[model samples]
Target: MVSEPSDAAVPGATVARLPYYLRALRDLAAQGVTTTSSSELAERSGVSSAQLRKDLSYLGSFGTRGVGYDVESLASYITVALGLETEHRLAIVGIGNLGHALANYSGYEARGFQVAALLDASPEVVGTRVAGHVVEHVDDLAAVISRDDVSMVVLATPAHVAQDVADRVVGAGVREILNFAPLALQVPDDVVVRSVDVGGELQILAFHAAARAAAL
Candidate 1:
């Protein structure tokens, strides 16, 4: 299980690059590349050689001086560091357009996340088959959470309902949440909330364009 951020904190930049390193390592491994130099790994991950070495140094010196790093060993270390070794239970809430797409998306399972259930507030949409499983009513969120031992909730609800749904998700003892709603959600200090606003990103780009026009 990916426990809360430990008292021993990792640098944010280092943490961010770990996933990229893991991805590169996995690709290399699949290609029958057993061992890789820091330079090669850096090229694969879009990081400079020195920066890659520095980031890996945070996980202790795993690379051999003369032979470079063992691909399998490095992959194992990064996997454990990112808490990808264990299967994480996840649930999708809202089951609207984005939510429905997420429920059907096959990529989450590849990254050690298992979609435990699909939930929506509408009775008309509920009980409809999504990816493979039918959507369940949001009234059953707690029941599903308990039955499935979901530790993470993906909030795909509308902005208006996002916060309330977050409160309920946190109350259900979920520790981590991925919010796709446009608005920010306020949660307890211990609860981790990550937001991904597609609309917000577009709006920011629009502002940049307007600013460029003004500069002209």
Candidate 2:
């Protein structure tokens, strides 16, 4: 594998690929597999062996050269690299239908993110329990973030309210946001926002379907 000088920051592509490595490592461990060769894991992760080695080098060494990698050790190292060594606390805003599903999702905890608070604007659903936390009014977002020490916020509100919610959370000291609402958000350069564009993904699928039919 090619080695570059010590990186001050992980490259964007490598950061994007870290989850695949982490998932492969964890899945292997669950199967009671202790040691794995690079090629073996590459097959499991769909990342080439060379790329896997390079990606893992970001964390130091894969493991002992002759014996291959120890599954549990590698997973732990990747977890630390991904900043999940210590769990990060987060809150989900807009507890409507989409928000309710996200709040109740167990996968977040499995990946080391704990949902600390839930917020919404509707008086009808406020104080209702979904995913173990009583839904608080959206007006209380700032107080909830402070009380829970929330570092991340997930936006699940309607398209119309997404930008406002994002502004409120950022002003309340949340720098990282995962926006599930189907709308573009305007935030300061210092703040980071990741958007989940479901419609765009569906459009791509539609394009592929049209191409297949045309070929036929």
Best by TM-score: 2
lDDT of 1: 0.87
lDDT of each: 0.87, 0.88
lDDT of 2 by residue, 1-216 (tens): 223335566787888898988898899999999999999898899889999888777657556777888888788777877889998998999888898889888898889999999999999999999988999999999999999999999999999999999999999989999999999899999898989988999999999999999999
Give the range where candidate 1 is weakest over 10 consecutive residues by summed lDDT: 1-10
lDDT of 1 by residue, 13-122 (tens): 89989989998999999999999999999999999999997777677767677888899988887888888899899899988889888887888866779998989998
Estimate the Cα RMSD of every predicted model relative to the unseen true structure: 3.8, 2.4
